[model samples]
Target: MSNISVSENEASSSEPENKNSPAVIEESPELQRASSSTVPPDVPSDEPPDAPDGGWPAWSQVVSAHIANMISWGYGTGFSVFQLYYKQTMNLPAVQVSWIGSVQIFLCFLVGVASGRLSDGGHSRQLYATGAIICIFGMFMTSLTNTYWQILLAQGFCQGIGAGLVFMPASASVAVYFKKNRSFAIAASGCGSSSGAILYPAIVQFLMPSVGFPWAVRICGFISIALAIVGFCLLKPRELHRVPAPYLDLKAFKSLPYSLFTAGSFLVYFSLFTILIYINSFAREILGLGDVKSVEFVLVTNAIAIVARPIFGFLADKFLGPVETFGLNCIALGVMAFGWIGVHERIAMYVYSAFVGFVNGGAQGLFTSAISSFVPDVRKMGTWIGMTLGLCGFATLAGPPTMGAIVDANGGKYLWAQVWAGSTIIIGGTMVLISSRLVLRDSAKPSAI
Candidate 1:
């Protein structure tokens, strides 16, 4: 007993040195002292360093991520204002105008593959700075555009490409700063994006009358540039020594949960974006509302999002887990979309829009956390998140136009379009449900292969 006591004392005395020592590579990824044991081969370990989850350093990263999201996706969602303006003034068919937003979203997703992979390789800051400059340049150019083609090239291609570059890195920056409260952290980070979505419409709706279109757009650009500079000055990657990873690691899909989640994400984005794009048209045509009323509808929806996203994340972290929460949210959103078919009166439509925004907004931000939950290796999270987003970008590209075409073919009735959106979202939810169950099973295992 004395020998055992002395040995324990000696080991305890050496514990500080063990904490200070460099992480040793184990032959097996099976048994780990890190948070989870599902890490794959080729990575050194699941955790290189413990995340400083609550310090100013960690929360500051969350703030930086919020700024990044505000500049990219928050501004992107504001494209509803542009869509409304173009539809009213362009005289082009809705289908043709829809292509502009589609291309913009498509490029945003498409660039994720390269940008996300590079972010994993320790290039996050550089990529974000470059992307910010490009986006600012694109916005300024958009302010100068008079022709449709010019808008497409400047706003759609350039802005979209720039957003794609910054978004995944922004999401990944927060992932490295927290573990236990990861879902809430990522969800809280989305607050800026939702706020941006709300603020932008007000910016456009108020500015266009007082400052005119060109200056209003330029002001929006200025806001984006200012916020981006703040983010660039402060944002940091916690794991400074993250090893570079492959842009397209097909091996990741071998896990059925990951693959199933990807498919679910594709369908979710595909169906989700359609409602956002058409809300203005739905208000003006179906409800006998005017331009201002339509803009208000968009504003109300996004405003609800500002509050909903973090709540979703909190629930995910506290009770449901990210995957299960995401699946449930998807199902809820599907039900809400179908409910849209029943709303026709002005008051009812307003309420419906708010609820829809609440559900969709939370769902949008939830996926970032959900996808992160599946990636055991935090170092490669950017790669995995970017790849999934890149693939889902195709759905975003096709969804708005596909729904628009359906509306056009159906004599401008939204019944079929709503039906399609609701069904697609429900199907996506089921896929996520399957993924959540699969992941729960894998986590129950004593050892991961």
Candidate 2:
């Protein structure tokens, strides 16, 4: 492992020590205590101080990170197949079916605070290994269950926790390797989810009738295990003296800009997943498409995302700053949400899915870079990011069920749900614009966030 270090004088002079700013000028005693375990005592300290950002090691880490996203988010987001299956086979209501996905997403985000802290303390590899084992176990257990509660405990809670442990560390590790090309790297990693989205739905769609549901899910589990093994082997952290930070940094919210940004993120996530969960059902129930035809909507959405995410990442890096790009993406998402209201035919729904998928992919891909602009200390990146996502976890957890309840209230009509989704996304986009303005007003460089 290679370690990077900065001199005390350089650290002090680069950024002013402001209490209100989300900047850490010096490692506190607590952080110093935590740093002890991050590095081995026998390792020589005469190496170098900056990462070889474009080297083989850095790129390998990127590849590993991409695999991690594919397994955790790609497979996780494709739960719409299971959502449809549970609705037809088990006679479950939309709300209950929504919980299975929501709980998985919720735990993935909520557990990031702890997982981020662990990564910051140099436990990245251990977290990945443990999560892989637990996730594999959870999937196998899910194959044996027939009841909702059993599925929820096995697939929802167990798998969710495992994914969280893998997700944060893999994601945060990318920052350790890149600076100038950071957005592009993050975007590339995110495409894994899009790839997974394309592959997994098609797999489930093809396999369900032939092999049955239990074996279909188990096959997905086996694929996850293989990917996790690859990720564990290649995802190495850039060795550095890590500053020990609190598991959760409540003080990050003290900055009004950060607080507003977090609130906006919460609202954005609240509506972001509504379409992904219900689009298949919408196509089948409302548009009268068959099962095979309906799953095509999901395939189109994720397939477009593969191209859109990297393009948006490049645009953000070269032209639009991350905050501006993210805000615009959210605005586009809101407008697209409204487009769903007018979609009645298969052609109309397909067009809607393509437009929304592109915009949503851009928004999600740029999210980490947009948030990273706010923090001065890169060491605390995991903790700050964890805090943002942890707060937003509640919204992700509640969004689907609330939308399901609205659909149920309207006797399966989706008009109100569309309205609800569009309105919240627009509101969230407005808050993002406000946060961007504050960032611009406070600093000469808007990218500074």
Q: Give the poorly placed runs of model 1, Cα more than 4 Å off.
A: 1-45, 445-449
Q: How well does candidate 1 score on lDDT at residue 306?
A: 76
* Residue-by-residue lDDT tens digits, candidate 2, 272-310: 887888999999999999999999999999989888888
Output the TM-score of candidate 1.
Answer: 0.89
Q: Highest TM-score: give the candidate number.
A: 1
TM-score of each: 0.89, 0.88
Separate clash counts for every candidate: 0, 1
Tell me the tens digit of each residue's lDDT in model 1 across 1-449.
Answer: 00011243354332211122442222221122221212222223464446777788888888888887777777777777788788778887777778888888888888988998898888889988988888888889988999899999988899889988887777788887887667778888887777777777778878898898889889988898889889888878775666757898787798788889999989988878788878888898899888778888888888898788889888776667777778888989999989989988899988998898888878887887888766767777788888898899999999888988888899889999999999999999889878877654554443312
Candidate 1 residue-pair clash tally: 0
**TM-score quality measure for candidate 2:** 0.88
The whole-model lDDT of each prediction reads 0.78, 0.78
